[model samples]
Target chain A: MNEYNSLLINLSVFIGLLLIGYFVGGIVEKRHFKSILEREEKLLYFPVINLAPRRLVEIGEDLQIENCFFVSGLVVIGEDYFKRILGFLANFFGGRLLSHESLLDRARREAILRLKEKAISQGADMVVNLQLQYLSINKETDSQNANNSVEIMAYGTALKVK
Target chain B: MFITNIDYVPSLKIIEHYGLVSGSTVRAKHIGKDFLASLKNLVGGEIKGYTELLEEARDEAIDRMILQAEDFGANAIVNVRFSTASVAQGAAEIYVYGTALKVS
Candidate 1:
């Protein structure tokens, strides 16, 4: 009877935590997506390119080349409890982990946006030769309960055209 | 000193070259911050602590690289590149490398 009661208690705690994660984590994720959308809209005009322009003279009339410098932005994003729970299950089944995928997507986009902002703040007409890198800060524990943190970085050269 | 990812500087000409200058650092997460991060992971958003950690590491590595370039009597570091790796559990390595050049 005692053993059964203990098991029941543990199960309840697990369910209770999951319920909290479901509601609270959902709200957080929604709010984050909304912010990302709004910020992206605000930053639409900050042009970023992956290739260096063939000729600087061919750039728009407004830009007169002055100087160029390097810029970078880094963002570290973590998954919510709800996503963690989903990831745990996905690990068991061995397939694409969508929960972690969305987390990385958000991180990558956010990092790029921040990089653009940095370039703009440096009086850059535009950013070129863009690059991105990602890292995961996952704890080494038993397979089931291990947690992972994802980080992304975006970098480029900002041209200060006068 | 000027630093850029591009090999060629539009205005400045490379007078001399100093091969490759590089720096790297490995960092381990603290237990306290790890616990806090796990808690923050529950509701999910940016982990400020880890972000700061990575930024600091990167800056340190870059600073070290600059120090090396200065020792080599270079005026600038070009083709600057950054890389990170997971050396061990709860630990990460940040590396920065570039070609040192004297420009005029």
Candidate 2:
């Protein structure tokens, strides 16, 4: 009887945590997406290109470049409890972890936005030679409860004109 | 010194070149921060502690690379690239490389 009571308590706690994760995580994700969309729209006029300097001239702007410097942006995002559980289930079933996909997308976009902001602040008209680097931290642990986070770094060269 | 990830800096000419310069660093967060990060994982969001730690480490790596370029008497570094690896369970290694050059 005591074992059954303890099991009942454990199950209740699990359900309660799942509910909290779903509601809280969903709200946070929605809010983040809203902010990302708004900021992206605001920075739409700025060009962040991956072209080298030589090819950049082909874009037809007679740019009398004055100064150039390097800029970078980095972000680290983690998965919520509900999504982590979903990831494990997806792994067991051999399919895509959709939740993680959005996480990555958000991180990448955020990093780019930050890079653009930095360039804008430095009086750069455009950013060129963009590059991205990805790294996963605390992923060495095989345990299910391990904390896993992804780091996305966006970098480029900012060009200014006279 | 001017640094960039492109082969050439705009409005500048590379007068001299110094093959390549590289810098690397391995970093791990403290136990307290790690514990807090794990707790934060329960809710899902940005892990500020890990982000700041890695950012600082990356800056340090870049500084070291710049120092090496300075030793080579190069005024600029171009074509910079970054690579990362997990050297240990909790440690990450950030490696940056670029071609050092004198520009006019």
Best by DockQ: 2
DockQ of each: 0.70, 0.76
TM-score of chain B of 2: 0.98
Query: Clashing pairs in model 1?
Result: none
* lDDT of the structure predicted as candidate 2: 0.87
> Please, what are the lDDT tens digits per residue for candidate 1 over residues A42-161?
989888887664444466544455788888899988777778888878767988887777788888888988888888887887887888877655556556666667788788788876
| Candidate 2 pairs with clashing backbones | none
Residue A118 CA error for candidate 1 (Å)? 1.9
- Models, CA RMSD each: 2.2, 1.4
lDDT of 2 by residue, B4-102 (tens): 998887788889999999999999877998888877777777788888888898899999999999999999999999999987888889999999999
Q: Where does candidate 1 chain A have its weakest 10-residue lDDT segment?
A: A53-62
> What TM-score, computed on C-alpha atoms, does each candidate reach?
0.91, 0.95
Output the lDDT of residue A134, model 1. 77
Model 2's CAPRI class is medium
What are the runs in model 2 whose C-alpha is more than 4 Å off?
none
Candidate 1 has an interface RMSD (Å) of 1.7
